[model samples]
Every structure is written in C-alpha cells, then in structure tokens.
Target: MDSNNTNVKSNADTILIVDDHPSNLQVLFALLESYGFRVLAVQNGENALKIANSILPDLILLDILMPGIDGFEVCRLLKAKSETQHIPVIFLTALSETVNKVKGFEMGGIDYVTKPIEHRELLARIQTHLTLKKMSFSLACQNEKLQQEVYARTRVERQQALVGKITEKIRDSLDETQILQTVTEELVKVLNTDSCQIELYDEKLTMATVVYEYIKEDSKEAPREHLRYHGKVRQVIEPIYQQLLKKIPLQFVSTSLDSKYTKLACPIFENGGSKGILGNLWLLKPSEAVFEELEVQLVQQVASQCAIAIRQARLYEASQQQVKELEKLNRLKDDFLKTISHELRSPMSSMQLAMQTLEKLLQSDYPHYKSPKFARVLEIFTSSARRHNRLIENLLMLCYLDVKSEVFTSELINLQIFIPEIIQSFSARIQQQQQHLLIDLPEHLPLLSSHAASLEHIVVELLTNACKYTGPGETIGLQARVTDQAIELSVTNSGVVIPEKEQHRIFDQFYRIPDNDPWQHGGTGLGLTLVKKMVEVIGASLELESYKGQTKFTIKLPNHHCTLS
Candidate 1:
C-alpha cells in the first residue's frame, strides 16, 4: 500500500490525470507540473485506476466523455470507495447545460470547467479547486481528529466503569471457581461477548483448566472444544508465557488468531509479580477493535486479580493437606496407646500363673518311684516361666524403640562358635520327634559385635517355632550367613505350612494362626512378636515368609555400634 510514496524527500502532494487525447493530456500535465505539483499521467482509465491505487495521488484530473469506463462511471466508482473518495476530482469537458452539470454532480465531480482551451481561465479554476481541496482536506482532518478524541475519552470512561465493576465482583469471590465465574459473568455483561472463559496455571506451570465459561445467547449447540480460546491459542502464546514465567506481563493484540476470531491476551500482574495470561477476550469477526490500548490496561487489571485469587486457592489446598496429616497422627496416637496396654497386661498374667504352679510343686512330697516324671513336669513348668519373663522383656525393648532410644548389651561373638552349640541344646527335642536338623553355619565366619544373648534368642525362637509346628518326620533347617549390610539368619521348616495372607500380620502382638490340628500344637502367640521386638531392641532387622508348604523366618543382625553418654 505504501509502494508509491516515491523516495518522499519532502512533504509534497501528487496529482494524477487520465485522458485519451494526447495533446490535451500533455498540455495539462505540463501546466500542473509547472505549478510545483507532482504529476502522474496515464493514457486511459485503466492505467489511471492502476496508478491511482499505486500512488494514491492527492488529486485527479479526470476527463469525462472518454472510451471504456467514462468519466461519469470512473467518478462514481472512485466515490464508492472511502480510500479514493477523498482524492478531489475535476472533470474537463465542453458540455454546457444545467442537466449536464447535475449529471456531473451525480457522478461525484467535485468541479467541472468548460473547455475552449483558455489557458488563463483553465489554470485559474484548476488552481482554485486545488487550493480549496487542500483547505477542505485540512478541515476534514481536524474534524476527524476531534471525533477521535471524543471516542477515545468515551472508551476510557467505559473501560474504567467495566474494569471497576468486574474488579469488585472478582474481589468478592474467595475461591478459584467463584472468582472465575464472577469474572466471566461480568465480562459477558460488559464486553457483550460469547464463549468466554478463564484458564489458570498450576504450580508446575502446566495448563490447569478453564475455570469459567460464558457462551453466546440463543445457542443450543455445545461450544467446540478446539475452537475455544484456551485450547487453540497455546502454541501462538508460548513466547507470551515465557515472559510471564519470569514475572513480567505483556499485551498482545492481533486480528488474525488462527483463521478464526481476532483475539487479545492481556497478561495479569500484581504488586511486583505476574502469573499467566489473563485475557483470552476475543471477537469472531475480523476487527481492529480487539486490541485497543485502553482494552489492554483494562484486561491487565483483570489478569492481576485472577493471579492473586488462583495463588490464594493453591495455598488453601495446601493447608487442607496439612490438616489431613495432623488427623492421621491423632489416629496413630490412639492405636499406640491401645497396643501398649495389651503388651503389658498379657505377659503379667502368664508369669503369675507359672509362679503359682511351680510353688505348689516345691511344697509337695513325691514318692521315689514317681520322682523322675514329676521332675520332667517341673522342667516343662520352669521353661514356661522363662518364656513369660522373655515376653515382658520384649515389650520393654519395644517401648524404648518407640521413643527413639534403644539400649542393647554388646559383645564380640562368632556365628561359627555360637550357632552349632545352640542347635546342640535342641538335640534332645530333635531326636524325640525323630526330625532331621540341617545346620548351615560355616567355620571361619566374621566375628559379630552385638549382644550374643539376643542373637541367640532370635535364632532359637525361629528354630523352636519350626520344631513345634512341623510333623515328626519333617526336617527343620537353620542357616546363618553374613550378607552385605547385616548378618542374615534364616530357619526353614517343612510339614506345617502357614497361610500366605497371615504371614504379614503374624508379628503383631497376640496374632495367632488357626492350627489345622489344634490338639497338636499350642502357643501364647508371643514368640514371633517377641522375636520382632527383640531384633528391634538390638538394632537388627527381620522378615518372614510362608509359602508352598514351608514357613521361613529371617533375622538380619545389623553391624551397629550403640554408644552411651
């Protein structure tokens, strides 16, 4: 459009002429040229239209009564277009009548002069209209400027009122959804638009979602998801977000937004901070109005409010998570208290009963013939007393770990020296049940620095449970080895298989397995629980598994140095 501006060294207007007569065009072109006016000459109306569009000459000397599109038609066509209408036209002809002048007027002839070729009079009329054209153009420009000033003031007032009302509505809303709905409702009311929505950015800067939507009235069809401003505008707006992430807001206004609506994205910022894009405000028709300077500022304010509300909503959600954790801790405290009570009372009752039974035996006088059987029963009774005392001891150790302090008696002991002797102590039971004891302790193993008594008890408990649970012909195996961070002692027994599901909860206090032959085996259910507690007490670790007609217990002795102050 600016192609014909012609180096444009200084401010000077240009004139264009169209005529078929060579003599008349040459003469007129020279005369306008002599007057210091830049002239453009074309032989016919076709060249004139091309040159007119190219140069946009300030004036046109259009000749009527010519071939093709005549002066009357050229004048009419030029007048139809607002871009060309302002270029003054003067028709040169020899017709002299009232009707002819009216016809020239009808065709948008600004002035007409009769031609017998009086050079002086012709120049005078040409000069008169050109001067008048300049004056009229100046006056029209001043009037246009006045209208623009009034429009700008009116637009500012309207934007202020709309922005103010919307701000009030948005400020009243405390939550994300409510704030979004408030902004959308106000925008629909004031902007008089359709399918408007607000989208928020999540903490990770990913697209969260549109919080509110306002569609055009009288539409029953659903809004197309792809056509919505939030979904479609993402790629074009990546640079916009890049600036926003650094906390700087920007305004982008364009009429070509996807082959569809003209759109604006006014970034939202607040008190030295910025969030994401706030204004996806759009108009479907191609328009220059979508990107007014006042509109940019108005939408920027709306953006600022949205950033604040969305950030506040995020903080609210975080607080809700904190409250949930506090509730969980409260429940944990209740469970801990209940567990402690059960751990204390159950062991005390067993020890009191064992003591009463042993005292009765000591006072009774037995015959010499029955002395051995009585002595065997007393041994059984005494072992039960030791088991009860071990229960109380395990509970006390567990209490220390719960409060972050565990004290264990440490000693340098060899697994090679210790494991075989422990198995030998259980030899009588192994032989009585006619069971095979497969021991896997190796000689020249690492010397373990830990409480030897607790390690022995953990291994013994696993072996004892295996012996008691399995049938007579089944084999009980004990294996101990040093693995990466700890010593792993595993005892596997065949004949009786514990259900897989109950394996996990077996360490919980008082948990028991449903024995298939209830008459054959019995337990206080404290052995494994106490085993787990003892391992924790000595800073060791434990795991259990029961599968495929075999039950295995594994205890890992940690190489830990527990020091005292």
Candidate 2:
C-alpha cells in the first residue's frame, strides 16, 4: 500500500522487533517496511527468541525491560545459540541510565536506543546497526574464503614437497618396480589410507591394469601378473593419470567424503601428464580444521612427493625401453637382410637363366612360331616367368603393408562379384590339377564398409595359399557372410592340415612349415603374412581354421565403420 512495500525485495535484510507494546510494533513494522527491510514483530522475549531462530532475521531490536524473559536474557540466549548468535541485537527502552546501557552491552546487545523515539532517530539507529551487521557478515565470509584458499595452497605445497623428496629417491635409485611399490606403501603409511595401488593404463586409456599389485586384503603382495578392469571406474580415473602423464596435478577426493567408501584413487601428476596414481586404502577424510597449519602442510608435501616419483619412474622406463627396442631392431634387421638376400637370389638366378635362353632362341629363330611343338615350349617358358613374377609381387606387397603404410580407403562394395570372378580366373589352373573350386558368396547385400584392393588381395592370397597346400583333385571353397558387426569371408581347402604349433605362427612373414615331403609346397614363405597385412589394412581381421582334412583362412571385417561415397 506504501512506497516501502513497493521496494520490498526477497533479498531485503530481515529484522525482528521485540517489545511488549502493541502500538510500538505496529509503528516500527510500517517504518521498517518503508525503508525496504523485512520486519517480524514479537510482543515478548520468549516469542522473540523463538521467531529469531526460526526466521533467522539479519538483525534484532530488543526492549531491555520486559515482562517475563526480558530483553537482556533473550539477547543472551540468542548470542549463545550456534545458529542465531550471528544476529545483531540492539536494545530499545525508556531507561537512559548509563547502568542500563552498560548492562545491555554486557548482555550481548550490539547497540542501544531510547524509547518514545523520534521517527528520524529511530530510523537512523536502525540504519546504523544494519550497516554494522552487514559489515560483520562480509568480514566473516571473507575470512572463511581466505582460510579455504590458505588450506588449498598448503595442500598443494605439501604435495610438492612430497614430490621433491620422492624425485630425489627416484633419480638416485635404480629399481623402478620397488620405487612404484614403495609409493603405494608411503601413501598408506603417510596418508593413512586403507588400501592403495599404482595401476597402469592401457594404450587406449579406457582400461586400468593393476601392475604387479592385487587388492587382496590378507596377502598384501604385489601380483606377478597384470590385473585389469574397465568401465565407469576407468572413465573417471584414467583422465587423472593422463593428467599425471603430462606432469599436471589431477588430485581427487582430498577430504573425508570417501572415508567410509571402499575404493579411493588419488592420482599423482607431473608436467601436465599423468604418470600414475597414489593409491590408498582405509583413508579417512581430512579433519575440517585440517588447515591447522601442520596438517595442511603435511598433506600438500605428501601429494608433491608422490607426483614427482611417478614422473621419474615413467621417464626411466621410457629411456630404458628405447635402448632395448633399438637393440632388438638391430637383431631383426640383421636376420631379415640375410633371409631376403637368400630368398631373392634363388628367383633372380632362375629367371635370369630362363630369360637368357629365350633371348638366344628368339634371335636365332623365325619370329612367328608356326609349329605346335614350339608353341608348347613357349607356354612352359611363359608359365615359369609368371610364377616367378607372382612370387616377387607378393613379397613386395607384404613388405609395403607390413612396414610402409597403414591407412585404408573405406567403402562398401560387392564381395560376390569379386569373389566369383577371382574363382573363375583360377578355374583353369584348378582344372589342370583336377581340383574342385567352391563359391558361396550371396548376391547383392548391404554395402559392407571396407577397402576393395586390400580385400581382393587378401582373397587372392588365401586362394593362392589353398592352391599351394591342397593336392590335385582336392576342393577349394570360398565363402562369405555377415556376422554381428563384422563380415566374415573364408577360403577353405581340403588336405594339408596345419599343425597346432605352426598354426599360431602361420601369419608370420616368411615362416614356412619345414618339410622334405613333395606334398608340401614351398615359396618365399610370406603368403599368409601378406594376407594378414591386407586384411588388417581393410579394417578386417584374419584367422585360420585347420584340422585333419580341412583348412580355412577366415577374415573378419568390421562392418559398423562402413560409409558410402
């Protein structure tokens, strides 16, 4: 109804009025409302205390002399309470005695006012007390914030100190595993954690491997094997270690919220990457008052030490691994060169002699071969040249797919057309040896996502393998089907069953099954390896199935990633 009511806001500071006088309450309520403040009027001290606690007014105006629980006692109770103690109380009474003023102050009154008040002085006093109350609250809030900041800084510093100490040990010590192991121990002993372990993240960063450490309560021994787990735990935790790897700090759960919870992870980081985590068990949340200087500093020191040590271990592992890898590479090159030289020389010499013979015969004889005998001899020479060329081409392609490139152009195409044509192309040779070829690919299907050249090459390689192994008159079968998110294609051949041990290594480049038996075919011994490389390039995987009378080379291509041009 008034200008004061028009400006009444939700954020307006609330004031409680305590006086036994009804007329005074009414007058003050209107006056307080006019000034844009919320007013709660109470007739007695008892009601004043009750409403002040319930409503949580920003300020309280009390009349010193009252009927039962007077203003003095009411103010005392308000100040004693944990919740209401923050409310600023000002006494308003007719008693202008210095004794009364002093007594009011002693009873926790922030200020005093004389009754039968002039409206202007009353408003002024109210305004002054409210300003003081606001300032007091602002100061309290700032103080709390400053304390939090100090605690956080101290925590960081403590962690840094811990890092420095561990870094000294890591740099000086030679045992990498022990250093990592001790970090867990230090976290448990120093941080007072119930359980802790440093887990290794896989290359994908989507799984955690508890390297050498198990979560068993009784044994408390690091496992010889790597224990792995995934899902939500990995999602939340891996980022922390990833940060640690960059030497960046990614600290989680610095307090008691996870105290009673079974699992807790505190990651240690350096230079913005995750090296590893500082694992712990039975760790309780820090005391709220943990900023009691010493505790805060200690917590930060521990965190720092753990981070530095993890980083140091990571660096050491990387350097040592590089050295060992280079040594291994040296050995691989030494052996590969020897084998390639021997393999290449045999084909080169044979082809060179045949070319020399053809050159001599062409130079001396007529250009047109009219005789049937001449044409038969020419066919044998041409067949020999083609076989040698095929071997060389397969070898080079294998090397390229294995060592030179990885990317494959994605597309959807018909395996049916390609597979059948490929079989038809090999039909003459199959018939020459009285061998049977089987084709089982379905007609026009969903355009499967894959690479055409790589897939065709894999099929050719598998068929070549089948031709080499199976005897004359045996059956070679080509089959294709879609399974789950993959397209499965298989090339099956009868006879030449792969042994168990050799089956595992069949895809290794130039790994031949040693045999003096004429039934066993021989080559540069890299067909299956080439097939694997091509299969992989096309986003498909290859597997072998071999038993007594049947052998199949199956390729499983991931179908979900397919896209159309």
Candidate 3:
C-alpha cells in the first residue's frame, strides 16, 4: 500500500498493465512504479478496460495471453472508446513468430516486447511512448484553442456585418416599429437563439413593452407577439432592469439558473442626459449557453444603433405634431378674421342707413322734426350705434382675454346679490322675447371666490344663449347649489334640442350650430369661446348637456374657496 501510494504521488502520469500471469503483472507494475510512474495492474482485459475508463491512464501495457480477452481485442476496444482512444498501447508476448507480431501491430498496438524483458529497454520504450503522449496532448490542446479563436473571430465579423446592415436600415427610415422588428429578426439569426425580443419602456420606466419578438421557424412553442409584461413577468424582470439602469453597459449571467430561459439585456440610452432608459435590446436563448463576451459587445453596439433610431423617430413625430398644431392655429386665425369682417359689415350697414334717415329728417321742414316718424328715426340711429359699440366692446374684451396678462382679479362674489343685477340687465330683452325666466336660488348660498368679470361674462353668455335658443313663451331656468366638494351653477333652456355632435364644438371660436334659420340668432360665434376662455382662466369647469329639447350648461367651482357661512 505504501509503495503504491509512493508510486502514485511520485508521478502525475498513470499506466495500466493487463496480464493473465500474476508474475508478469507484478513485474510490469514494479518496473513502472520504480521509475516514478503511477501504475494499475489487472489480470485480464476486462479489468484493464474498466480501470482505463475509470482512471483514464496515459498509457497501457497488455500481455497477449489473457484469460477472458487477449491483448489484441483489448487494444481494439480501447482504441474504439472516445475516452481511451488517445492512450498509447504496447503488447507483451513471448512468441518468436513474426505472424503474431504482425497481428499484434494490426490490432492497434504501437510496439511488442518479448517475455524475457530487458528492464532498460522496456523502460526506454515506455519513456518514449509517454513523451509522445505528452506531446500529442499539448498539440491537440493548441489545435483546439486555434479553432475556437477562428470561430470567435468569424462570429464577430458576422455580427459586425449584421450591425452594419441594421444601421443602414435605421438611417434609411424613421419608423420605430419597423426598425425594432428588423433588429429582433436579425439578432435571432446572429445569436442562434430560439427566440428574440426587444423591450421598450415608457418615459416613466414603470412599464416594459415588448415591441418586437421573433421565434425560430422550427420552434415548438407558439409565437409570441408585442405585449406589455406585467404581474409575474414584471416582478422577475424588474430587478435585472434596475441593475442595468444603474450600470448601463452591464453584461452578467443571471443568478436565476432554474429558469428555463437565459436572457441578455442591454440598455438603450437617449442621445443626451440619462433621459432614463428608452428600452432594452434583449436576446433570449436556452439556458444551456452562457452569454459570451462577444455577444455582449455585439448587443451593446446594436443597442446604441437602435437608440439613435428611436430618438430620430421620436423627434420626427414631435415635429409632425408641431406642424399639425400650427396648421390648426392658422385655420383658426383665418376663420376669426372672416367672421369679424361679416359681423362688422352688418352693424356698419345698419348705422349707415340710420345716418341717411337722420340726414333726411334734418333736411325736412321744422314741423317735420317734431313728427313721431322723425322721432322713430332718431331711436333707430341710437339703437344701431349702441349695437355697434357693444360688438366693439366684446371684441376688445376678447383681445384682452387672449393675452396672458394680469387682467383677472379674483374676489369673493355673492351670487345671490350679483346674479340678479345681470338678470335685471337682460330683463327687458327677455320680456320682449316673451320668455319666462325661472330662478332656483338657494337661501343663504355660499359666496364664491373667482374673477368677478370672468364669472359675470360666463353667466351672461349662458343666459343669452338660453334666451336666443328658446322660442317665445319658452322657459329659461337658472339654478345654484353647493355640494360637499364644489359649488354647482347651472343654466338650462327648454325649447330646442341641440344636436349631440355639435355640442362639443360649441365653445370653439366661429363655430356656430348649423341651423335651418341661422339668421334668426345673429351672433359673431365668439361669445361661447370667449366665455370658455374666461372660465379656464378663473379655474372652473364647465360642462354642457343637451338632450331631448333641453340644454344645460353647468359650472363647478372648488368648495374650498367658497364661504359656507
């Protein structure tokens, strides 16, 4: 035992000896062990093959006359096995026959030795074969390393080529979806992955959207599509995302090895300032493969290209949005000017006719000046002038409201006291139109904090709309109430049912309801738009509900500003 232990510790290379003769096995084991070779001795070919497989000896010595199996057959079996095929085999025989020697060599033996072995000659042959085995191993290792390097270089070149093509695609198009789809398809081929996906994130980075996905044609799993990952998927991916968010250029194997899939994530950064993570370029494969350094580098480069494309696409979209807004603004300006021209001409023509009538009245005899018809001409002149002046005043107020100036002064207004004065101003017109005005006012109502002029304008526009839409003898209703969180003021008119579709656009400048008789309600169409702007400036919400011959406009104000007492 001690001798064997010493033999094993003395040399790193191992030798296996197979012989049926105990004497031959002992002789070979002792001879090899003495020369600092670790040796295993067996009495038959069966044990020899077993030990060879278990310990993987560097060389084997076989005696031809074995009981169960002979040296020739043993050598054939060893040569066939992948693990033992590289081991050098030498045959031991006492036969002087040249035919046996030739047969031994035919069975994969390197050399044969006679039974009366010369120890020095035997040692020299063993040494020679062991040295050859050592050289063979070193050469094999070098060849393997060279092949790997060549393969890696070729792979990198392929990846770089793919990147160039994708870069060209990105440059040629500003379509984000198309670029991402191309990236996933190309990446799946380059990485030789079963599946690939590119994940995009919202500006908040709280959600991950799978923008593009690709599954191999031969894959058994159903194909996945662009989807947002949430719930369990989010929980699993969030930690990885956070790690990459902090160290953007990170590449590490995930710790969760139990998962069936392996993933590589690369951050996509915007052009400037950590605009947060735009998204991730994710490569997925079966867990068998560890992510390689070359793959990491390729994904990083691809991610950068994708980031540039995404930014360009986003910038283009923003420019398009701005262009649309400008076009809409220009259209609004043109409409405003046209409406102003028509509104002004009507009032101007009326004033001109009144002036011509006054001129005739003045040229007539002195007695005619005191006539009732002459007096009626003066009244007509006065009414036309007042109407013209009111239109000018409304236009000026509109101009003032459009400017972002400190024109609005908020104050505590008691609707119970302030509303009646407005109603009184419109009373004569309401009576002339023969419409019934119903005021549903709550006693001891709360005082509202708001811009007085803005509020008055809003209410006046609502009442005027109610009167204009209602026929003679139709009822106009005004109601006010206080809720737990807000003050609600509503004005309702019952007569005409405004079409549901036109209700939304009623607050737009120069947008009037298309009525059969538009001439009956003469308006510049700026009244509701001006009122809407005033309400917005004063921090109130206005909602209009028109259905079944009743139209109601409600204004809601925050209760915090209202004096409940």
Candidate 4:
C-alpha cells in the first residue's frame, strides 16, 4: 500500500475490517486511512461483533476464512441483530472459485474481491457503498420529519373541533347553572383532567362560590368540598382567585392534605375581557400529568361562552321581574276603580231621585209658591247632577275596557235605526248647548253586523264630543254612507278645528287638547278614548282630520255581508 495518496482530508464515513490475517489487515487499514476514511481493524469475529455493536460503523469488510467463527457466521450474526443490520459487507479472499463468491452473497456479503491485491478497485467499491448508505439515512430522517408535521396538524384540527362542540353545548342554554354545569362536564372530558369546576365571584369581588363541578369516574382523589371563601381572608388559595380576577390565567402544582395535583385557572369575562370578570374555570389533573398550552386555550374559550350565557340569563330574569311588577300595579288600579263605582254611584242615584221628588212636590203640592228664583235653583241643581252622573259613567266604562271585563254580543244593527237612536239620546244636550244638529242618513245605508252595545257607545261618545265642542248655531252632523268595503259613519263639528299636532294624542286616556276646551265643559276627558277603544272592540277603524274650522271623526265598520237587504 502506498502512503502518498493522502489528498483527501478527514471524512466522517467509518469502516470496520474483520480479517484473520494480520498482514491483510495492516495493508487494508493503511490504504483506507490514506483516503481520509476512519478505519477500525479487528482480527477475530468476536472482536468484530463487539466493535460493531459499540460503534455502528458505516460499512464492514469481512474475510471468509477465519479461525473460531468464519466470515459467513459473522455476517449472518450482524444481519440477525437489529443494531448493525444495515451495514454493507464485502468478502476479501484469495480463492478465485465461483462457488465461494456465490456462498458469500447468500451470507449477506454485498460484494466480493478475489485477488492477490487490488487497492483502487477496493476503494472504488467502498465509496459507492458509503454514498448509498448516506442517501438512505437522509431519506429516513426526512420521512420522520414529514410524519411529525402531519401528526401535529391532525392534533390541532381535533382540538378545534372539540372546542366547537363545547361552545355549541354551552350556548344552547340560557340558564346560568345549566350553562356552567355543561361547561365543567365537557371540559373534564376534553382536557382529560381528574376534575373540573367553575367558581363565580360576588359583585364586590370579595367572595367566591363554586357553582358547578365534575369529577372523573376512576379518580383516586376525593371530591373537593364546595368552596365559599372570602378573598384574601378565608382560604389559602385566595391568591389564585385574585390572579384570575385580574384576567390572568395560572398553572400551579397544588399540594393538598391528601396528595399533590396540578391546576389551571382561567378567567371568565365578557366582551373580550373588557367588561367585569364573571367567574373562573378550574381544571385539575394528577401531579404526574401537566396541562398543555392547547388545553389552557380551550378552557379560556369555553369561559367566554359561559359568560355570554350568564349575561343573557340574568337579563331574562330581570325582564320577568318587571312584568310581574306591572301586573301587580294593574290589579291595584282595577280595585280602586271598582270601589269608586260602588261608593259614588249610589249617592248620585239618590240625589237624582230626591231632586225629581222635589220638582213634583213643587209643581203639584206647592203650586201657589212657585216662583222664577225657585225655578232657576231647580234647573241649576239638575244640570250639575246630570254632569256628575256622566263623569262617573265614563270612568266606569274605561275601567271595564282596560280589564277586558265587558263581553260584547254581536247583532244585526240597521244604521238607519241605530244612528237615529244614538242621536236622540244626545238631542237634549245638543239643544241645551245651542248647537245645530244635522243628520245625513242615506236611505240606502247598509245594516252593520257588529257588537251592538259597543257601536252604540261609540256613536254616542262621538256625537257628545261634537255637541260639546260646537258653538251656538254651529253644525254638529252625524252621517252614514256605504263604501266599497264597509259602511262609513262620520261625526263632524263646525267652528272647532282640533290642532293637527294634538289630533294623534286625542284618543289617549285622559289626554285633553291644550287650550281646545273653551266651553269649560268640565268633561272627564275620556269620551274620545272610550270611542277609540269601542271601535277596536267592534272591528272598526277610526280616522280624525281637522282643518279650516271643521273637525271630522270617521269610523269604518268592516262589511261582514250585512247588505241593505
């Protein structure tokens, strides 16, 4: 072997040479070393196996003829063991027989060299096998990297899917306790924790209470006692609660009286943590198992959903309370109205009866003493009694309508007859007010099928309003006509124009037009409101228009097949 061929610097490829002849080992070692290859020469198969097991060289060259164990046995042993199985082996021998070469290959020899010696040929073979081995190792490493990346991606997708499931379950409920309970159960399963719990803080942030908890079935630790601790006062774990209130998540190893465990606490907040803290979510696992980053993020996401559910449930409760309060107030109002009707109407009836009796006595028994002054006093008393009676009736009617206590019975009403009767009831008042009354009942008007009493009250109220607002000699007209869809009845009063701005509110209960009552009518201000309510009860619509010293109120009753016939 020539030592002058040392152009190649130190290289990393190592080769193990196993030969029984010392001379062959020396020559091969010097040749491989001159080419910058790390060489290890072992004389026997035992040492060869030992060195190969220790260093796992890039390639091995074994001689066929040996003392204790032949090259064939060594190659078979190398291939049998998993550690050195991939190393390429080449047989070096002086035997030129074709049978020996074939046997060498069957024993796991990759190539064979039959010679006195051929150094360049051997080096060429070594370089080729080393290149193949390096390429194989590089490919194996790349394959492992790709496998790891794929596994990581799949894990992330699975975690995201679980988060979506937990979110859906929590959001489906509006009950605060139910929402919290669901969150704890789902978190324990998803995070593989020994236990899970949710603790809510008081409004003042001075105390915390455990609202929900879940423990794994086979967990060795006993269930944690329900917590109701004052912050920084009662419990040693108060600092954890304080940290969570500050919107920070914490992971720590907690040593309890029984055993040690790991815990993670995340704050529950609304509006991306901008609002006040609602509560905290807690997860616990055995001390040997640690919480991962992805698990922490999952807890935080679920906590946000829980906050939303809690807020919605609280709002719903508040609205229910308001509705109850309003119902209570309505009941009280109805009771007061009933009491007034009973207490006041009885005396009003007696006064009217007494006045009637006095008039008859004066006309018949005291005919000689009848005088103008006495007549004026009698007239004044009658007028005030009548007005007082009307006010009581209006108030009672409003109460009935409000409570839906009045049941209206529908009947066929001939407008020709009905309108005239309503007008007749108000005829005396119209005359007393000095208002000119007009009637426009077309002979061909259709009969109305509706609640008769409601219709009667509606028409009477409208006519009374017209008579009150119309001045002396001003026209107060009651008219009825047939339209394509329904029968239209309208009440019009001249010399009074209700302001456009106040017309919309005229039908509101107790709402009076400002500066519009010049007659000091002293009305209860419920007449028009009563009309509007009665109109709706009878399936009619009312429209008001006032302009140019004239005001009109039209009531359209739906045509329910009650034609003129």
By TM-score, how accurate is candidate 2? 0.41
Q: Candidate 3's residue-wise lDDT over 1-565, tens digit each?
A: 1135642665567888888888777777778787778878888888888888988888888899878788889998988888888889988889889998998888788888898888998888988998998898899999999999999889988878977987887867788888887787888887887666677766666777776777767556555432213221233255677677763654454434255556677887654545566777777676678678877878788888888888888899899999999999966865685578567767777776777676666767454556678678776677666666556656656656646436666789988898899899889988988889999889989888888877888999889888877888778999998889789889998887778778788888777777622227566678898878877788888888888888899998887668855
Collision pairs in model 1 = none
Model 3, position 416, has a per-residue lDDT of: 88
Model 3 worst lDDT run, 10 consecutive residues: 226-235
**Candidates' RMSD to native:** 18.1, 19.7, 19.0, 5.3
- How badly does each model clash, as a count of residue pairs? 0, 43, 0, 0
Candidate 4, pairs of clashing residues: none
Using lDDT as the yardstick, the better of models 1 and 4 is: 4
TM-score of each: 0.42, 0.41, 0.50, 0.77
Order of all candidates by TM-score, from best down to worst?
4, 3, 1, 2
Query: Which candidate leads the pack in lDDT?
Result: 4
Best by TM-score: 4
| Model 1 lDDT per residue over 417-530, tens place | 788888988999888878888988766467777877777877888887787777777889988776666777889988777776877877877677776432254665777876
Q: What's the lDDT of the predicted structure labeled candidate 2?
A: 0.68
What C-alpha lDDT values do all the predictions have? Answer: 0.69, 0.68, 0.77, 0.81
Winner on lDDT between 1 and 2 is 1
**For model 2, what is the alpha-carbon lDDT of residue 288?**
36
